[model samples]
Target: MEEEVENILQKGGELFHPGLSVDCVIFGFHDNQLKVLLLKMKHADKWALPGGFVYKEEEVEHAAVRVLQSRTGLGNIFLRQFHTFGSPSRSDRKLNRELLVSLDLEAHENHWFLQRFITVGYYALVNFSSAVPRPDATSEACAWWDLQDMPPLAMDHNHILQQALETLRKQLNDQPVGYNLLPEKFTMPELQRLYETILGKQLDRRNFQRKMLGYGILDRLEERKRGVAHKAPYLYSFNKEKYAAALQDGLQQGW
Candidate 1:
């Protein structure tokens, strides 16, 4: 074995390369489609979301961004901290237990493989047009998958992804940031797609439009996509300041 690998085992007790790791469940929307980021783990023959350990001096968020950049080649994208997963079962002993038996290592070190560890989960909202997926040192490759059709994943990654979906829904339901899924300039149907995806229900177009217009968070623009056969819908952008101000006063949009 290599010296670095030797040292890892030397210091390893059941902690299994333990450190403060951040996992990003990156989500993107394009053409009214929803997707999530996933990566293939090296030597594991399994797919997982991109994750990495924090440097000793790195801030929690900085670590997450580093992981994102290192794995996905995406830097400085907006990501939100949602929840932490730290169950004894989550950092599963079964995975480590198999490794321990296969490696012919001392039994004492086996516990280190199974030791409890905490993982902070963050969800990033990426502009599908901007994100360029890349694999990290510990991954073989990376790609985005449709939420409607995801491949099998390792290490509770599917759970993490589900958590992200729930978080996005909560944000849409309460905070109602159409910006999470819509572009800077969007048409009415484009805006509605974002809400429908998050809320997981088909909305009545006329009623929904009436209610959204009443919110007064939309700023109409003169621009419109040219050459469409139908009446080209007018362009509009979110009034972020107005929405934030409303949030301050306890106005919320429930899912």
Candidate 2:
């Protein structure tokens, strides 16, 4: 453990660019609730999003992907850069001071860790069931928390989360990105529930079905969803081919 800490300190400058970092707001859906991944730091009560410094040679988006993979043990997921936070004082000093003391960082190491960071924010949609939550080297634990019940996050993460959710809401209307949060096969109600979770409102069932099906992005399968309380709804999968074509030609006759 001492060697590990030393190794991290030695490579700190080379492995991470001085002023830039990446913070990922990974959203998942399970048990009818939209969840966000949060990390508990060693000896810290404040929670944080899975975040890391960008390597000197890596692109920002790639760095975000690396951070997400390191924290969650999942990859090849849909990630999109939503915003960049470059406030002169984005890092919280009090939190960093306590964290540095807890980690017993050397003077130079503490200075490096407390430097001003302009973070690129990325939001990802992952299938919750497939995600194996893992803490990064600096964190003690990691878990999913419902968006409404999140713990007080360190830094400006609460603001970042709000921004990511707003971006996701806009994307849901313009893109078929919400399919990333779902299984390969799901019922119309399941899809509706996912949208409701994001939009924070109940969509009219018949109108939602008509509008979603009108996009020609869903492929209705003959298979019916099992383990339901009542009549099993038919399963449907998003058609990649159709979605790709629609992206080129525009959906809903360019409405």
Candidate 3:
């Protein structure tokens, strides 16, 4: 692992952009809870957002997609760039030095990975059950943490996560969001729960149903959820054509 770190830093200049990085806030919805994917560092007890440096030949957006795909093993993810963090002190040299020391490696003053970085923040929405989280060389574990109970993140990651969440909440007013977060067929109550979780509040059920149906993005299936003791709720799925159209041209109403 020490050799691997040395090798990566040695080739960093040839392989990746020096001062630009991409950080992803991958959100997943499960059991009515909102979760974010996080990586636990290999030799340290710190956690961080899944992130990586942009390749020298790659576009920033493509770098974000690549970072997410490598971590989550999911290709078709809904991603949106939210912000750029470029504070001069954003990169914590102290933390970097501690991490390197933990790996039993020493980096010189001119090391590429030790430089100041401007990170582009992107938020991705994926189906909770579809992702197979995998850690990178610097991390030992990749797993989902509930948004309500997330651990302290390294660097400016907590702020980045908050900004991403705020952007997602604002986007809910204009875009269709649940298509990637929910299963192929789901109940209206389930969909409502997803929205409520993201918004951090409870929504009136009847009003939510009316607005969602009026958007014309959902198809009400004849079948209902099975194996429930109470009267089963009717199942619904996104109308792909309408959903795509809605996503292309903003939705008519806001929640």
> Per-residue lDDT tens digits of candidate 3, residues 1-255?
567766776688789988889999999999889999999987667899999888888899999999999999999778989999999999988777776667656667877778898999999999889999999888889999999999989999999999999999998889988998999999999999999999999999999999999999999999999998899999999999999899888897644
Name the better of 1 and 3 by TM-score.
Answer: 3
Best-first order by lDDT:
3, 2, 1
RMSD (CA, Å), each prediction: 4.1, 2.3, 1.7
Write down the RMSD of candidate 1 (Cα, Å): 4.1
Candidate 3 error regions (>4 Å):
1-3
TM-score for each candidate, following the candidate numbering: 0.80, 0.91, 0.95
Query: Taking the tens digit of each residue's C-alpha lDDT, what string does model 1 give over 107-143?
Result: 4644544666688999887777767898765456888
Candidate 2 runs further than 4 Å off: 1-6, 108-110, 244-255
On TM-score, the leading prediction is 3
- Which segments of model 1 are wrong by more than 4 Å? 1-19, 93-114, 243-255
TM accuracy, model 2: 0.91
Lowest summed-lDDT stretch of 10 residues in model 1? Answer: 1-10
Rate residue 227 of model 2 by lDDT: 89
